[model samples]
Target: MAASGISFRVAQAVGVGGALWLSGNIAALSLISIPALVRSQTEDSVPTSILSRQWKYTFEAGKSQNPPIAVATATSFCYLAWSVRAGTQLGRLVPRNSIALYCIAAILTIGIVPFTIIAMTPTNSRLIAIAEQKRDAGGSVKPNDEPVEVLMKKWMFLNGIRSFLPLLAGATALVAVLG
Candidate 1:
């Protein structure tokens, strides 16, 4: 019993910490990074080379940052799952909100990967393709498929939604802790 209690507390700490880290990262990407990137570019059709470089840099930066976020998300999900299971086993001993918190946190943390696949992956692929083409062509290849501005706008909009989910998850986890 004492061991179980200790593990539960450790899980709670890891879950909340990971959630908070993910939330901050998402918020920065949405509110600062994307916006800055958008602002740096023009609304008019820009040179393919310039846009390609920007896209490549952005994508690379995101790739670099993704591992830590992925780890945090996975860690949070694992701990939240443990808590949910443990709370369920405790039955009446666990408060309803506490159980709900575990459930909500688990769902949101796990949901991000699927959400990215469905919502963001298509655009990301398109952008990556365009970036590669531009890189290979030595900056002369302009994407005839879509305007750079349009793609960036779409990416930013979807990313805003992406950012919101983690923030909400973190907030929920914090509330769960307080409750």
Candidate 2:
């Protein structure tokens, strides 16, 4: 079935919007939020439990929200690719390579899931474990400051890398559309 003009436009918008939204949020989390939290911890001598709890909350919130957006964005990109390939515009001048670009965008967007699971799960698991341990101990155990900071630093670095996937996806899709 051919995509109506309006349908194609909407799907493009969604794909573009969702990819950017995912990228921006992850960027903010990695660049702004987590850094600020860590800085606060260092400046204020915040307790382990409190610090871990804050990080935990932030991590949990993102975990809940980001995956779905990635999936949705990928779906939209795939649809756009199919629409273009299926000849949505009879006389429109979509390049032959646009389909490949759209497929690349969709792959990049959706690939964040397994990327996170495979690359980030160990760090995430350790951080969560620290938070849980501190919480379970009634927020009394301080543990080693170095370990917590080390983990946080590692997580921030990994997260920063992860943010780029969606960014690349958005750029790829936008370029394909504009061409």
Candidate 3:
């Protein structure tokens, strides 16, 4: 019984550690994206100057790289947390559905919104490149596709959602922890 208690406590620690690591990674992603978000928010259109062009490319490159890293962090964190819980006495004490709910909430409020923004942002080379590829494939130079206003609007809306999600998740996590 004593050994079981020790194991359970260790497992709980692992779960909490996973949560902490995930949270930290999310925070880091948010910080990394902040400048790009600001640039997107402030600029009316993609810039034309050399420096602005360089910055835009830099931002795009960063956006592409950040999402995969962030997703990996979230996946590893969730896997660790879930695995730890599965081994614990609390696994029996806490309803499985409740754990599922927590995981869903975590993924929704933490993993999805922010990552989606990074993935979809106009300055993200992947999105722009895809747009370009489609345009080139269609063999059109007309401004009919990916208008600046449309891209800006989409980026703004998604980034706004991404900006607010971390706050929501933090509050939810606090409630879960305190209650």
* TM per prediction: 0.77, 0.91, 0.45
The sequence of per-residue lDDT tens digits that candidate 3 reaches over residues 70-173 is: 45434533543364376565466555454554455356445554576556543454335534433344444334345443444455455555645434544443
The deviation in Å at residue 16 for candidate 1 is: 2.0
Alpha-carbon deviation at 92 in model 3, angstroms: 5.6
Q: How large is the C-alpha RMSD of every model relative to the true structure?
A: 3.4, 2.3, 7.1
- Give per-residue lDDT, candidate 3, residue 92: 62
Encode model 1's per-residue lDDT on 1-179: one tens digit a residue. 67766877777777777766766775576678766666666555556567756866876786677556656655665565555554355434555666677667767765667877899898888877877663454547754588666777788778778766666766777786666
The collision pairs in model 3 are none
Instruction: Report lDDT (Cα) of residue 177, candidate 2.
Output: 84
State the lDDT of candidate 2 residue by residue for 1-179, as single tens digits: 24466787888899999999999999898899888878887998887777777889999999999999999999999988887785456225588888889999999998788889999999998888878873444557556545777788889999999999999999999999888
Question: Residue 44 in model 2: shift from native, Å?
Answer: 0.3
Candidate 2 runs further than 4 Å off = 1-3, 86-92, 134-138, 142-146
Regions of model 3 farther than 4 Å from truth:
1-55, 80-87, 92-98, 109-150, 165-167
> Model 3's lDDT to the true fold?
0.47
